[model samples]
Target: MTPTPDPPATLCEAFQRTVAARPQEPALLALAGTALTWAQYAERVASVAAALRHLGVRRGEPVALMLTNRPEFHVADCAALHLGAVPFSLYNSLPADQIHDLLANTAARLVVTERRFLPVLHAAAAGTSVRYLVTVDQVDQTPEEGVLTLEEAEARAPRPFELAAALDCVGPDDLVTLIHTSGTTGRPKAVEITHRAMLSQLSGSQQVLKVTDQDSHISFLPAAHIADRWGSHYTNLLCGTRLTCLDDITRLSEALALVRPTLFGAVPSVWQRMRTTLEGALAEADPGLRALAEEALATGRRHAPRRWKGVLTQAERKELDGADAVLAELRRRVGLDRARVCITGAAPAPEGLQEFFHALGLPLTDAWGMSELSGIALIAPPGMPRPGTVGRPVPGAEIRIADDGELLVRAPFLMRGYRGESELTARTIDAAGWLHTGDLAAVDAQGDIRIIDRKKDLIINTGGQNMAPARIEGVLRESTPLIAHAVVIGDGRPYNVALLVPDREAVTAWARRTGIATAAPWDTHGAELAAAFAGAVADANARLSRAERIRVHEVIADEWAPGGPELTVTLKVRRAAVTGRYADLVETLYRRGAADR
Candidate 1:
């Protein structure tokens, strides 16, 4: 491997150079259907930076960002970098108390947020030291009593920096981005990501995904997460690509069609939910239409090339081309035809899902990394995907497994360490500069990594038994019309208990076939489909141990809500949240004593 290239002196100047080179090009597309040219983007960033400096935001001080995915977020972030103040993201949905704690913990004086979220800042800032709050939205909604509008704040100040010298003090080792972990178990710790670390991630992603100036991204994912921060934001900035950030999930589909992006980042749940929606909708329609849809999908899957398998022959190629028309129509409906690549990260997506999309002609590439590594650790090459595996380590990164099943990573892209927690920082990152990723994983013969699960999530029963819920969930997902996600609840009790969130449409269709009359819908649907889910649960139980078996459980109609203990912004379950939310339900599952069996 060649020595890594040097990083730019400052992240802000790099953007300015790019804008100067491509002023008229589209730099950002917002969920509101608004587009910003590189020139416009640069102007906004400059104004915001100047405004921040005038407000006495000093270099090296932290500026907390609490806005959702919007155009202001980009401008505010770029502007903060220009002012040489490290920008940290706080989950916009975090409870006001938690938000206040984070603000005090990070010692941030300046905060940027949307008008709607100002109440949270008000409540959280009651006794905290956060002195100024700037609302990022364009609406003239009544600003909180003391907080100012981001626009007004900027208008009051002069341009902060006229040239590179003003930003020359920001070196590669200086903090560029500070991301906080999803504080499920404890208070969230700020991860210091330096310019060098971010550049390392950007370079690796560019090489692996072959991102170019022509590339376009739909950036609705929370900028708080490293996956979205690097893959959807910084990568686009570094490669001179265009980014489209949407307001919410409702606007995402429209944004996709409008932007017709070449590259986008997604989590597995999004892909799975979309697939389930399409399949269930088609299945419920008339027999002829359902058959036609299934045939089209199957045909597409048949023609799609397998990543792990060898290349197809000439005859195979011809057959796939013949089915191109049907597949193209299907792709358009799914809004993925324009996408050259869809990168999935944060969690392991089922391999079969990746193949299904590939068959439809969308290359769904899987990547692996953590918040500590700034996101890009490994990724699959286009058309060379290995399903279930998180591809190989990104360029300039190294991965190794310990004797005890822990995955370790060493890269310049690694964070500077957990902020203010020297003990945890020392424990997570070793003297050798390797991050001890607490995930259990294996590197295959082909150098692909298949992560099993977090070592911490491992279940240790009272009977001295250990089990991985992820493995059990994987097996349960194999069932036709599969489960969305399952959380095993039994720990100290005699056996495991799983609280399953069923694929509602699938279960509803199964009900229609089984002749179950449905009167009140949605809320009562879970109870109505209890018997069906039980049968599936029983089948899964047969494969588990006495301690690991899910003896009894309940079904939830919809997924857990984000910010509602059960789900993270990326839609991953906080196990503690899930267990705590349904503690009574879990206990009811095993209410009957072990002797009863």
Candidate 2:
């Protein structure tokens, strides 16, 4: 059977229809305290679309969007599609040099950015093919004299000209957007998405999530990533649901309270940090407050045992009911009540973290996807969330594990090909339409798939013993309070040693409790550092298997950064990078560096 084609050619048509169906429904909100109805949002999208056409944007041209999580970013994206232009996003966190390289490679005609990012654009525009620089907000000056404010262009351009008819030119095969993966190991590749691909993905997502116009979600993940765009922005567009955008993560808690969103998407790193923050604050809190928080978390853990399988035991269900009442009060205190489903993606979240929230009556759903698949391949359903599994494949998608334990996927949502890299694309997606996911996964008789780890990321010691670091890391994180990332290194060595990055806040509280002289856990405190970190390592080792256990862990003082030998651009730990950087330290650890302790 053929898949359904993408509708809403100009985005104007799709949105206008939605507005007509429910004109008064709120469509968009910002953490900065602004809301727009569907009717109002469509008008803005149309005005922006008209503006882009007036600026000489042609169909098939690539428009680079370099803005943060503001309303204009979404408007600009919809406008690009309206004019049949492909929108490519650049991470705002990137330096101007990286931005220049991307623009030069993609040959983008225009660069859409926020006013605050004008200087960076100007720096990149010193001498480039990029002619028209479009800034969403007011700016004093632009690097390129040809720069046009989005406001100016929209106001000056006449009302959109028969957009519904103009959209007839776009086909399902037309490129809808371009996203550059962080490319932790190599140069970023541009992933091209088509209208049909996006629509198919949204269809699969809707079937699993049951999202509708009544649902509101928070958007903060970089749109430059395919997962963030499809899961947060495009899904909302198709469902006619409202999305709240917040550019600053510092204001996330505040944003949550105000928006009271029903859905939210974030990586494990962000949620792990939140857990660490709450845990640390509780440690230093008043005795009464500390006890209350502990009781609440304990009650939640009992209700929803972190390691339980899909079917809850009778005792578990009963415990959950008793725990739910206590957790309800805790939810009110933590401001997580309105967050009906907190979605985790990009990496496997620690299972304990998932159950902690579930016990508290919040659905922390885990999703799996890759850049090539246009974001999601599988998502845990609300009714059947199996711990440690990424849940079932979304509707219309198929997942099969190869004889060697590699997970392969095939779906309409697969990318057309790696932009301008036909050979690489062919190697990834075969003639039979199966995408070799490069991941190792396991499936039970019931069809739930649990991603063990990346095939290449697995560790094999000299004795021919293989281990999945992700599993060990997950267990270790649950055992300790402050550790954020655990990279087990012992491929050719006798035993595994790890480089652990502590949650700065959690470590600080532990240090203070022991009367340690360290100002911060991330700071170098001389000899005392070895003793403090050793204790944390010992605690973590208690939860690991003999072979998987860390012999000793070195505490780093700095946070991990991409291209800095510790982390990938997506904020995932780079096992190879860590080993390369700390080759000398690994030798010392193997020589029984902390045996005396």
lDDT of 1 by residue, 493-542 (tens): 55777777766655566567656665422453445455556677777667
Predictions: Cα RMSD each: 3.4, 3.5
TM-score of each: 0.91, 0.91
Q: For candidate 2, write residues 224-325 as lDDT tens digits.
A: 887668867787677788888888877887877787777877888777766666666667789996786677667666655442354666786776665567
The local lDDT score (0 to 100) that residue 141 gets in candidate 1 is: 66
Where's the lowest-lDDT run of ten residues in candidate 2?
A: 301-310
TM-score of 2: 0.91
